[model samples]
Target: MADAGYVLPDEELAQLQKLSSDFEPETTGPLVGERQSSAAITTEYANADPVYRVKTAALPSKYAYFRTCRGDGHCGWRAIAFTYLEALVREANVGKFEEEEARLMSINNLFNNVGINYELIIDFAEEMFDLLHKLAHSVSSNDGNADAILLQAFNDMGTSLSIITYIKFLASAWVQAHPADFEAFITTGDVKTYCSLSIEPSQCELDYVAVGALSAALIKPAGFAFEIMYLDRSAGEEVNATVFSQPTDQNGMLLPNPPTIRLLYRPGHYDILYKAEDFPPPVQQQPIQVALANPYNDSFIPSESSVDIMAMIPGMYSTSFGHRWPSVPYEFDASPTPQAQVTPVQPYTPTPASAAPVNTSRQDYMPVHASHQPNHSNTGRHGLHLEGPPVTLPIHSLPPPPVSIERGHLTLERGGPFRPSMYELEQINVPSFQTSIFKNSQYNTAHYMNPDFQPEAWSPDTEYGAGHKGKHKPPAQ
Candidate 1:
């Protein structure tokens, strides 16, 4: 019997019992439910070969399109060839291969067997995608010669761009996935050997990958700042008006911008752009002179406080010197020292007005010494006498007058004969080699008399003489 409140139908009750049974595992063993089932589904999907799928989708499109399109024979053939090549590469890069045992395996086996990195396989996939996109969008409808040339150029550019993009992506992914291996390889500094297998020959191909990998390894982001110095040529001074940040793309290409600082003279305007990290520490303010002949082509010369205007330009001109901020050190020690000490002296004071009135007239003073007359006028009187030699004026001494002589003749003192000194002749010495040869007489006589008697005498047999010959003799000899 069923309760009155429950009102359960027979079919509905059976369905609920089934649902409960499914939710609860068999009590006899262990419970296996949705988690395990979901994992199995994910594994199956992941294990399915991606390369096979790419090729299956790519090849049919490659062949079917060319068969249907009716175009210029030459152009059509070219497009067909490019399509076939793209398909072949995509096929090689994609899908799983079946074995004789009918076992399924991951497509990675294809790349792995060839010693290709798995990430490079992905990059190749991406590269094919780009090439296919370009091929689909190509507009080669015009049959003119110009159109043909343009089409060829575009095709070449496309190929180059695609190849470079593929290499960059491949290197980047390999480095990222196998960081430890990449680090060990990079430490050798011969990455070219390791990378040569996968890397393209063009520098552009490797640029992005190398930059990205190095940026990650070094952990330094590239940045640039421009210090804009405005020059007032008339005033002969420069003012740092602003510092501008240069904009760069994620891939590190600089953006174009107008000149930050304007100057009266075009050549005077200078912009020095350098990496922020590479810039040296700021030192004393260095005055720079800029030549203004050609605005684009100018020269920079540094000076202390002012630059020579004449050096900048050949013509003479006055220069104005201006500085935004002086780089001089301003702080100093204020402690007192012995040499800098200050002394205080007492002020002179006059006598009080009430004490005395001093005479002001010149006649009030008396002389300290007076002439005295002797009391005894007789010649026999004893008197104090001073005895000393008579004082005489010194005679003025004058230098002798200059004497001019003829060019060939030598001047003498007043009038005297010129004579050569024996000391001067004795100071001269003859060379030892010359003295030795002269003593022997044989060598000196032949040297002086015969025009061909040479100091550097040489013949094939005795070319360098005994001294040089012995020094450079062959080991066997």
Candidate 2:
């Protein structure tokens, strides 16, 4: 038996032992408890993994406290659903549930409209909503035990798991509703199987689309933002955080706060995050980049860094699927709203040799079209680097896009994008080789090259004056 090869399906294991009946086995204490200083947890990881420690240290500064969700694979579902209920509690505490009540009941229709029978998921949905209704209903019923009851319900295996199940249902319906929005991401070409196996089950770890769908469903009726702070061992000095942010204006800058709720993600787990007054407000954002193809110079060489940036580029993105339709199942709607298409400013497509910067080693500036407007974030007290020209610095030469670190978690003052996904940079139907010379270059995969050999500071104003075209300026010595 010890020598036999075996792979136990996690789903089957759950059914056999009835495991998801409680929070993850290793999960710490009760469903909801008093918030603790994040440093308590961060300090534990500090010595062993500096990356996680430094990232975790910033957590307490931003969110004075956090509420943990048992890491038993259901944390994502519990984290969002729990926060939504707590939000309702606060509303009830202040005697405000009229609107919430109507919204709660209305969401039931989404379950049915998406072709899911309510009876199948009724037990869980009912238990979850009953506690939620009580949160708002306490105003009229005057139930003083709202907090106690809510906590008990969350801790209870039956009700807690039910609500989590409903969250998964909503995610499934979301996929069913907008096949186009998430279709490409669905490999194996089977959305239903993917949802059933990956999303709509207990203990299933959520992926990007699931997070997007779940956050959208939770926030739609309430008009709130759901931000997730990613705490992984990603390649960065600090943790990478993204938001299930609301749709942005043309410039891609999100409205301030907007009643935003934060979630902390640690690899496979998620927890609730709360903000306090003591944390320092993040300083200005980093410079924003947009698509603008310089048809002027074609002799410039694309750096290897651009290749990495290219890989990060993803197709079009949206805050919520089905044109931001509030939680309802869009598939059954009589008429869906028009798509709020994201007008990507990455407007540049390279032209021939004339469109490139000179042979200045790693500095191949791309002078894009006049309409190549980069987003202007308010963080830059020093105006956008794009004030004068339609030129873009080498994607690699510049700091990371959308986010640049200066103080704490700084969003680019030039353009702070809280977007959830990024795509590769390519024009419509452009042949692969045309985009980069390296695709067919004499270079092989074995060679190692370091672009940071002489990492120089760049200033668009000083580097690219009004008439500095085709003249590639080397880094300042």
Candidate 3:
């Protein structure tokens, strides 16, 4: 066996020898020399167990190959472990590892522990296609309108739940980020975080939430009609005109009507209309005139013909003069009576010798007659002469009497005691010759007896007229 063709090559035998020398047996089992010889023999034995035997055929060699080089020339332990895990996966039906599931799971876990980061949240949203797919599949499988409704409800519920969950998560995140604010909230016991968060909710938010459950129960799909009644407590008894209109689309056709909404008010409510068409016409009226009546008696008559009877009809009436004429006229006689003629009495005149000097300065003079002369022989001392009776004489034949001068004393004589003469009697001038002698005498007496008396001064030339001889007998001296 050593020299024949079955013998190994030198390099090969050397390699075998090296392998055998390096092999060491346990002390309790065998000696090193025997183990080496046995290992060398085992390299040739092909029928031995490869894992257990060190000699007999190539079992040891096969075992060394199996340990160092796995089934496909790789390590056997790692291969075996991988194969076991693979078998388990197949049995459990855990599909292939998905990157999307891992990503979704990571986001879900983040929100569950802390809060939703809106930035990250958008990634977990399903596509419209996916949503429609699920919805269609569910509808087809369930095959009922109720199922359709339920499906929509479920979707709505899901959206609501997601929103609510997100809100809760956000609250948690805020608390974590602001611990002081959280402590304040806890102390105050007032959870106004949503209101205080500065997120302004619109009218839709309030109304929708208020009517959410009711709306959900009543709302139906297409072809279903809804009626709702609303009582207006604010409306008064009299209501104005109410109006209803259908909101239109761009093409002018009415859009789908919203649910019917009713407004109830008091029956007698009157509404004032502002539009001209609703107004009524106004009414017209006519005017009337009144007349006054007369109250006087018909038998009573007025004095004047031009008087208005209508005016007197209302005045007082006189019954005593009713039958008598209102006015009367009287008659007068026009006759002349003859007068008797008598001889005129002459006026008395004084001779120049007896007469006092005529005051030429006196403007007023009385006319004298020849019957007024006193005899020249009847003279007193100092050329004084007695006054004869007043002579009835014609006014034109005698010289006008001297104008009587008003003075304190009368200068009757030049040297003798002054004697008052009734020269005023000769000075009297009468317009009528028929004047009574007694009346003339009375006037002459009044002048001589008057307390304030002054006799008229006579000039010597006037006393002795130009017809007489020069200064004869000084008037019976």
In terms of TM-score, the best-performing candidate is 2
TM-score attained by model 3: 0.15
Off by over 4 Å in 1: 1-128, 133-155, 188-477
Tens-digit per-residue lDDT, 63-106, candidate 2: 54466676667777887887777766645444335565566567
Candidate ordering by lDDT (highest first): 2, 1, 3
Measured on C-alpha atoms, candidate 3 has an lDDT of 0.24
Better of 1 and 2 by TM-score: 2
lDDT of 1 by residue, 354-388 (tens): 11111011111111001110000111001111121
Worst 10 residues of 2 by lDDT: 445-454
| Candidate RMSDs in order | 43.9, 20.5, 77.6
Q: Estimate each model's TM-score.
A: 0.15, 0.50, 0.15
Better of 1 and 3 by lDDT: 1
**Model 2, stretches more than 4 Å misplaced?**
1-28, 92-96, 139-145, 247-256, 277-477
Weakest ten-residue segment in model 1 by summed lDDT: 372-381
User: Which residue pairs in model 1 clash with each other?
Assistant: 51-94, 51-95, 52-95, 235-320, 236-320, 236-321, 237-322
Assess each prediction's global lDDT (C-alpha) against the native.
Answer: 0.24, 0.47, 0.24
User: How well does model 2 score by local distance difference test?
Assistant: 0.47
Candidate 3's C-alpha runs over 4 A off are: 1-133, 136-142, 145-159, 163-252, 256-477
